[model samples]
Target: MDTPSYRERLNRVLRYIENHLDDSPDLEALSAVACFSPYHFHRIFSAMVGESVAAYVRRLRLERAAMQLSLSDVTITQVALAAGYDSLDAFSRAFRAQFKVLPSAYRRNDGPLEQARRYSIGQPLFYHLAPDVPPIDVQIRSFAPMWVATLRYTGPYDDCYPAWETLMAAMQTQGLLTVDTFACAVSHDNPDITPVDKCRMEVCLSLPPGMTANTLAVRNLLQDKRIYLRVIGSNSDYAVIEVNGPYSLLHPAYRSLYWQWLPQSGREPDDDPGFEVYYNSPQSTEPQDLRTGIFIPLLMG
Candidate 1:
């Protein structure tokens, strides 16, 4: 099947899920939305989206609940019930597991990043959050569609650096690395929602135009290494911010963008996962000197 066709079907499924979050749509109904068979839908959904259907729905529900808690005056029980939990105790347990705070506490706190700091005490990376974080500078930028070769790692975000090394080495051996190559990291799971041990990160390098997964050279290289080639489509409007410190700062930067800027900016984030473009190698550059660009896609009118 053509890649675009597959993507189109899955995108439809995503929209369907978002609009019907409270319904708790069954697998058969979701599969029909994507025009896929019930037996194969779960596997395809997980493979294409990087998470199972149930997990995706649950995360979206909790995320919505979080927005309501932070942005509105909704009661704890009401928020819990809206998130699909039958009991307040069950919702509180789930919320605390995801956000590290009970619904009431999260509502009272300044933001999720602030709450995360309490649990991360004594960690150097988290120390930056102690001081009041300055307002992040965001630029609206457009990006071109590009192809990237990626290596997927399933583990703690801190431990995924080796995956980048392995991917870069493999690409270099194939003579794919060049002066114009771009390196990026795609985070598939939110640390607050997914367990740290189960987080997924895809270390990626942009391939030169005309290089793709179907290329004979790339196909042969993938025979041994667990690498994937996919296209990142263009977006005319992306809320881009530059981070110029240790990687730990990225979490707060994102929090500021979503929790602080987004509501006031009059822009809505698209469903696509945001990605980070690294400008320098952490191995060579000092943590304070490293630079990264965070790109969050915006929904089109």
Candidate 2:
């Protein structure tokens, strides 16, 4: 298969593993999901992902358990059980090894929970248990209301690119993508809190004055009153990241924004959903050269 097709298949496997962390399917099932023989699947998965499938699943489970421990009032045992551990002792050992703190201590104070690196559609999408933390520069600003043509995707954020492709095609057919066109992604749900299959995001483009098309739904993005931290080259209030590469790598940037930057920034999340603005066209630029501005909304005084 071609590279993009291959990455898509690999992403499917990753999504399945994440969505079913509580009881992920067996190796045989995963092989089938990847559409490869068990032996071939194992080798390819390790080479492309930099870890064994079992290892990846274990890490993801522990990571989810850590999120629950830090974010919710759930008991350690409950979090352990939900993370597919049969005994708290076993869970504690694994969690400590991965995060360097016991689950209970992590619950009381989340300062020590190591931030996990997110995966994407590139070759060798390795899991970095201890990736270096990058510095974030945030600019707060108020954005005017924008009229946009959007296509909404209600599933795993990783799976939203197809919706974007469709939206772009519809726009092209309707002659909407002109030189002045501006594109953005609107994410309505937090992936940590929302089920993977139920997350909502909109692929949007700025609508020319009085332009209308049946294929695209229109939305008014109004944040005139609140301030946003604009990063990634957008103009709005929220945590932002200027990411360059395939859209898949954007996940890690978001994880850093929420888990690392927000706590240090002293700002709180606003009521509006987070969104992204695209600065380069995917069709015209190399995947590695694509620049996207990710805008996260925050409450401001």
Best by TM-score: 1
Candidate 2's displacement at residue 5, Å, is 32
Flag regions of model 2 displaced more than 4 Å.
Answer: 1-134, 192-195, 210-236
Per-residue accuracy of model 1 over 1-301 as CA lDDT, tens digit each: 3264665577668757866889976999999998999999888999988789998888778877876776556788998899999999999898887778788877776446445445445643223443544557899998787888877676899898888888888888887888889999878666665568767677889886688787776776565336667666475689999988888888778766776567668888886777889999899999988999999999874
TM-score for each prediction? 0.68, 0.50
Error of 1 at 276 (Å): 0.4
Each candidate's lDDT (Cα)? 0.77, 0.64
Residue pairs with clashing backbones, model 1: none
RMSD of model 1 against the true structure? 6.9
Q: Residue 250 lDDT in model 1? A: 85
- Local error of candidate 2 at 1, Å? 34
Kindly give the stretch of ten consecutive residues in candidate 1 with the minimal lDDT sum.
Answer: 124-133
